[model samples]
Target: MKYPVLFSPIKIGTMEVRNRYVVPPMATGLARADGSPTEGHVAYWAARAKGGYGLLIVEAAAIDPLGKGSPWDEPGIWDDKFIPAWKKVTEEVHKYGAKIAIQLHHAGRQTTHDKIGGQPVAPSPIPCPVEREMPRELTTEEVYDLIEKFGDAARRARDAGFDAVEVHGAHGYLIAQFMSPYSNKRVDEFGGDFMGRMKFPVEIVKNIRRKVGNGYPIIFRLSGDERVPGGRDINDSRLVARVMEEAGVDAIHVSAGVYASTQYIIAPAAVPPGFNVYASEQIKKVVNIPVIAVGRINDPLLAEDILESGKADSVALGRESLADPELPNKVAAGLTEEISPCIGCMQACAGYLFDSTKSNISCLVNPFTGREGELKVEKAEKSKNVMVVGGGPGGLEAAWVAAKRGHKVTLYEKENVLGGQYRIGAIPPTKQDILKAIRYYITMGKKYGVEYKMGVEVTDDLIMKENPDVVILATGGVPLVPNIKGIDNPKFAKAVDILEGKKEAGTNVLIVGGGMVGVETADFLGEHYHNVTIVEMLPEIAKDEQAAVKFFLMERLNKYGVKAITNATVREFLDDGVVYEKGGKEEKLTGFDTIVLAMGAKAYNPLEEKIKGKVSEVYVIGDAIEPRKTLEAIEEAARVAVKI
Candidate 1:
């Protein structure tokens, strides 16, 4: 009764989903390179299903050999050999009272030759604006053949025990490429006019319906608006929805943005929640099929509102589900506050996907996302008194985990507040969602019966007095004030101080260093119409940030008229200006009312060495161990706490 609409069952074709919640397809890169599901994939999906999600749409699986999105481990339905692996996932999901669906995908021009073993194919020979690789225009015969390939994929999905199959026609993939004039410039019947452009996807739906039968559920996911200048918009999507509906599509899952508008695709915290709802609403009016709204629809209340307002029949949780797989169960039980909020940092999720270093999707706040099978909170062999220093994310998580495992935990924070640097990190524009995450941890600590002692700085004497069996130092970090000339001047302030409101910047400002903190600071200051200039010693600004985040940050900076100078090393600070070296030349850039140093932080582990012998077990986590991202800090804390 808490969320009747959200918990209400809905019929998609002949199948009935238990609720309006749908886990839309998101690429995890958790499969084998040969396009087979790994044990990780099986465990990941099963956990979400067991968590009470009504329906789970598995991540995109290529329909053919050349359609694979990345050179890495993206699942595929091209081969029957892959069916058994996906069948394992569907069977596991079904065991938990959930209906499972698979998204049949084709990368088209979005992929590279190195990825698919040949040049990527598209509706036209034109290359993608971002990828900039010319694709071999699919011959008319090849286009029909590709349609049959989609049918074959749908058939395989049914054979694999999936209740429904969603066609991946969004986010600048093959179907989207053909629909958008921006990507599809071909004069053939598959392109050109609106109906011509939509011909490919319509035929695809018909082909899928033919293979899966008229009664089989078919979910068609498409970008309601490509968000590009000349790209397909909601009006076009409305027509496409009608066509697909007439072509036997069961439900329409509406999302927004193409790859070029990448920020709108994954959607960082900077983008507001329910961004694609308007688009879904527009499409819903034109079509009778159940319309599912996606894109930053994180909060359960918002999902309920969207459904209650008659915007869409279903709400698709993408990255939000990754942050907390048990979101549905939590909401259904009226334990909404306990639901871990997706902060939308995108650090481990989209960040890893774009970075190519750590491509396996994971959550920033939830450490047990991908490793549900491996990383579990088992009860400790013996109860222990745990002393956690600092009430930042790391300490809070450690305390919560330890206390949940039946340990007596005391969490100490030198300051009155719980969040450490995270509070300052959330001070940036559109980043207030982070405070929700901090509040969740604080609530978890209290719920787990952690003894929270505010304004209590843990020292050697305090550790000895408390006499705890284990001590975790999440003392966090301090600003690294580099030993530069004139750096001690009072006019220069730390980035954290400005963000924390302890210090203020003037109208004209110069920030030294262009890391995540510095860039976010510039954005925060830029919002106030401050004239900001960023100087970075690296080749690129915000180099340490995720690609999509950095892209949006740079766009914001440009919009705010913030200037950036990269590969410029600051030598000294002047009373009126800053001196730096760039390309072996000494340059003096003068004209700043105040100077800010966002040169990153140094680990603050003062108590670790002091309390080593005082405690039975000593562990260091978070910035106290080494300055790292929030994801690493929380994960490290959980990893250490669970074992203890």
Candidate 2:
């Protein structure tokens, strides 16, 4: 095999998986209100197993109703009534010759009163900084009851046909609360020193072993480093792993971060992929059990290197699994380029999971992630001649999906290169992932027989000549040219022009906006030794950007010494800089050698009106209808393509 260690079979206790590929526990938020696994959830897990994963660890299942920590639709094993529904999921996964495990968890202080119906419970009364709610400390007697609940949950998982049970002692959950001194402030046996903090998870593993018997596998997952102030670090996790091993855990799954340190929890595109393998290596030094490393293990070669180096027994793909469920199968078939890569945008999965209005999670790259049951692309009843205008992410996705579904698709791009604005977006540092996605779409488009007509303008006459049955207008957006006096400088450049290498700004560059594109353009320029200053009308910069992504972006901005002027707007463009309004006062800065407009974008549906009534079935998708991120554009494209 090309990836020998990654594709090798490994045994965790009595369970011998088909290969080392693992899909670690990730909440789908597709369960019923009663906490039963919905058909979508069942199909989601089964699809991963069928994709050639050796084992799939289901997301956090509450041990009690009040333990619900995530979405309103979190899975549960608190009652035996939930077993039959869970059994269906495990049985379906097993049909693909894959072993399945369930992670027993309690949200503890991470939850709110609205979620658990009351004050949350934890090892101490300390309030979680992120949640900002004080938890009611568990009584000594109640702590013992919770321990038994963990054991009972494990036994129930076994009965539900799961091959193993994972104790969720990570990510500031209930078990982690008892393990971390940052949260465990009690003076009882469950608190105090390292050994005391270790007692809760240790006892839970022992109880699980007693209840489930010795043969059933018991995996204990914990954060090697909490990545917070005064919280447990690698030294503490090294001890936690050894103690869990002594308590009879069959394997050790190492993850990182708490709620406050969620950048590590769901590291954005700015964070390096497979950056936490060292944590698994640290934990592996102290424990004899198998250590499964998980932290953006997106690439097959990266997973293989971790295994070959003996740092981890297996690697877990989390959100990357959502982006492409068939990653393992594609890798095994040597079709790695065909696998759609996760761009780490986090707009859909983390964004939707946290939004109360959203009941389920989906992927920016693959919208079929959560809607696996109903969102599928089979051959169409009758092939249609599809004309896709533009070659941005939305246009590429629509062309690929439509052509894959038995349609004759011809994608038209006015530019010679594809990816449109997305290609320019990938020019900033640490943004190669975005380029991978653009390439993936193009490759998939080619594979599915999408005819490429680059540098060809799609006029109404040309459309009528081709006589396409359907017209998908993904003609994207254009830079919003603000209406300011003296703004039409002959040398002035749009942010996209700077990123596209069409314009070169002077050493002292003044940026006119502070949105995602504006800020990233500053970073791109700052790297080239340019003095950058961003001016925004809003109080904050990149407010709409993902939190984790913004965290890293702001750090880089500070490192590059880029100055930001917020709550300000340029009233008049000057010869060098501009006259800006800030706090009801006008100020002028004239030292800048060049001024660039980063003032966001507006919908550029130039052909939508001209061809709408002319085409029989005309649909304006993506930025042609609205100016937003590639997330919504591709999501709308996927929705339209499957129907067509």
Candidate 3:
């Protein structure tokens, strides 16, 4: 075997993957509210196939309407209406020369029935920890019916032209509920010991294989660890893997955690990259079939190493694929610069999915992510000159989109360089790769003939001088300074100041706010310096952040000895440390060092109304409209540019 063997073809039953790069199923909630495939879902998956993935596993589709885990609007294959819509997806994927697979799933106790309008059903009468509603337990006869539903869904997928069908048995889902002792407490045969608990998943695979016929491929996705105490671990997972292979499973797609164990499903930033690979390696040792590994397989080199070491047969990219669908294609062509890196900040991807945000999944760096087909670089009609103000995510995105459409785009920034806040953020220890994305956009701006003017702030006068047809104001936002006493003192520093090394701090530092920015900075500083404490008035740290990221932030805080206090209000700032009030007690603590404020940001809308009516078409995006994460900025900018 050679190093490039990772890209070699492999067979799973009658189906053959063109290469070992598998686009694993990630629940994007891209479907319609009624479990039907929407145009957005079709376009999203088609982009992956077009990007040269050997195998594309569609996002989880419900086997039965009652199996819905949340109100995420996931597609369903149990109904006749879904077959034609799914057939369109298969046809699109095949046209791109890629093999497609549909991952069939049931949420069990995790289901909320919000979209389908019903209560959840599970192996035992247990409710998910996060969602407190109790699930109705299914009888043995009902269990048989559910098993047939799995088969029916698989048969529908096969008839719809999907080359393979995957039974989702991981992440404490319906099948996993039967396998996990922590969730499955039923005294019956389906819930007693390991073998009995394992029986349900094995039966599903057998029934799926039988329904799909002799040579059809049936992949079983498994979670190596439940990430909860008394939950299934690697040793148990290995046993389950063997049982799946014996029951005619062609592949074992390995992932980790459940939505119930928030930290496990979305590993915290503290968890090392490729942290879950060891479990897949362990499962591979027990099962003869190929094992697919997924979990922060962001870097192509890391992914290559996993495949080269024989730890797993294939690498499944979840968020990485969303960030840049062309990663595998670019790597194969040795066009690494074209790849847009996923920052692992699940804000738009998993976070928005959970929040039910209507905007498509956006990459902080990849401006052309979800709208690849719709927002292609069509030649401009008149090739009008365009002036874009600011050099942040929004400005860069607008400039690129305009230039790609053959417009003469000029971008001006007040700073000496691009990236805005991201430039400072990239140096924040664990987030060094964020800078690479900024550099990629700079290169793209140049490649597409977008003239960039650094150190030149675009004011109303500057815009009037340019006299362009359109003016896009992506000027970003300003930091919000509180009205506290001593806030104006030179001793105080902004989080950006600390990141940029413009201000010096002692070994002991206290960050005023416990948001994501504050917490991450604390983690970075704590790793390098002596002591760091975060003071917040809220009940928890990183409350505005997604649960997945918050879990990781909390873990890093614990590891780095960073102190976090909640429900504490900062009364006043002293020369040494800030005084606080907690639980009706006023305590003044004297510290040896510097104070950094990481509260939040304010939208810089001073120029929006100023330029809107004055110009032919004025576009205000990014932090200029409202301060948010980078993904939101880039997506909004691109969306507006498409219409203009």
Candidate 4:
């Protein structure tokens, strides 16, 4: 279990990281709309630090008043009011014996007027691709002002009790826009040649060094490749990394892509693990400063190999950290099975943060993400026996939390095994990572002394016989079968039936629903067996999903050649075909041997009235509250468990 060079301590300027496991700067958009930190922000970072990360760098906080990017929640250091709030975060990390840093940023052309209360001003008058807003080019005097602003932000970060400061010069932001020829099309001294464009970022770093002095660590996040055809590439990154090192940067964090090249930044699943390690290796070879590599560094062994091979000094983990903040700690303690794995499904964290600003940070599998403090399971006043109904993610999490709080907990599941719906998701070729989460909960429940009763249905009489103080109904939802002509026919099958081996799909299959579940089922079938056609009543598949997750799902479905038919209703199921209407035209498609129903699920709330006043405390969570993603179910169950 010896970690390769990943566990080696390395010094960056005056700061020494206990290990090479660095939690890279990733924006969760958990701040208040007015650039203040929220409790969610505190819980998010504290979890990672406590989980044993060597250094946790906060997300990009703008240095200038007008440089804030999105209209949603993102923190800033532009004002003095932010100091005490940031100090709260720093103190929480210090308590865990982990060093923390803040990434200082300027969005430049990437800034949106809605967030900053003014139009964005960049180095040139070029219009942004996504924003479509023309920016007023900055004057030389304004450029100098920007440099000083960055310096002041660095000084404030140190004063705020941060161990280090990171200048966000990557991801096609302000300094990156200046460094990239694709955005900085200016002819002045700050433009024209590569050195001219590089001048601004170097000057910003130099000024930051002058302000923070020689003792403080200052790392530069560099976009190794813009990934846009003619934009910033490795050559440009190398040149800039050397300049940053010469300008007194203590480290270079190599990353890839921008908003323009979406796939590169996010690094789709098709991309290999440690995909961006090449960029960091290139930067590390040329610069004296330490280089950190990110992008799909999910496997601990793989990360260790990258460090041992000298690809970079540190492995920067983002989604992995979000998936399990205690991943490093678990690995260090040789409890690898205890780690909750992040499956690279960005639905809960980045997906919700970008799509819905109001929702707090979440994990697809981990329910206690943002509500860490409020959701802690404290020992019960008196040891009361608890009975949890069902064995899904919600029920399992509730049972585990209650047991941790020293409650005598017992769980009952009608099914022969645990992981209700999650077991189906686990079997799909693309969803192996989800199984890790299910296993983690099961293992934790056993560790916490919870009694598990599988294949046992809990009725009112059964619950009365148990005589528990608290009854948690996590009875999972059932699929809502639409009253279509062929839905109940022998030729048709429910998606769950196919998933659970109750029914088998033929070579040619017609999936009746196009929502997230249906679409995923289609993708699964199409990946292993061809001839899968998805028909939906809605115009778009996965209509309830977040934009980013839907986008990736759509891409995968297309890649698998899963034909999607929307705005269509199923008419009848035939022995050799399916009848559907598209645009008021009746179309009978032949040659499909099977039809799978995947419309959606209905919440099973059978115990509402029965458990309403029967016990001192009654809680309904997961699918019983609402049929939603595993993320919502787990989060709801955890929140309620802590309160109970």
TM-score, per-candidate, Cα-based: 0.97, 0.98, 0.93, 0.94
Q: Which stretches of candidate 4 lie over 4 Å from their true place?
A: 38-44, 263-272, 357-359, 546-548
Of models 2 and 3, which has the larger lDDT?
A: 2
In terms of lDDT, the best-performing candidate is 2
Q: Once superposed on the true structure, which residue ranges of model 1 sit more than 4 Å away at CA?
A: none
Q: What C-alpha lDDT, on a 0 to 100 scale, does residue 474 get in candidate 3? A: 88
Q: Write the per-residue lDDT of candidate 3 for residues 192-308, one digit (tens) a residue.
A: 888889888888887887888989999999889888888888998988899889889999999998766766666534457888899899999998898999888877788889988
Give the number of colliding residue pairs in candidate 4.
0
Model 3 misses residue 354 by how many Å? 1.4
| RMSD to native, candidate 1 | 1.5
What is the per-residue lDDT of model 2 for residues 207-324, given as tens digits with 9 covering 90 to 100? Answer: 9889999999999999889999999899888988998898899999999999999999888888788888999999888888899999988889899989999999999999989999
Tens digits of per-residue lDDT for model 4 on 1-644?
A: 97857667889899998888898877776788778887777888898889989999998898876888854666889888899999999988899988999999888888677767788998889877877788889999999999999999999899999999989988888998899888888888899999899899889888988988989999999899888867888988898999888888899999998667655666534456788898998898898888999988988899998888888888888878877889988998888888877776667766765664345666777766666766676877887788999999899988898888888899999988999987787665556667778888999999999999988978888887878888989998999976767566766788888877788888888888888788878877877766788888899777875555566667877878888788988788676767889999989877887878888899998876886777888889888877887876887778767767
TM-score of 2: 0.98
Candidate 1 vs candidate 4: which has greater lDDT? 1
Q: Please give the CA lDDT of all the candidate structures.
A: 0.89, 0.90, 0.82, 0.83
* Off by more than 4 A, model 2: none
> Candidate 2 local accuracy as lDDT?
0.90
* Model 1: how far residue 86 lies from native, Å: 1.3
Give me the candidate number with maximum TM-score. Answer: 2
Q: What residue runs in model 3 are displaced by over 4 Å at the alpha carbon? A: 1-3, 113-116, 268-270, 367-376, 568-571, 579-589, 605-615
Candidate scoring better on TM-score of 1 and 2: 2
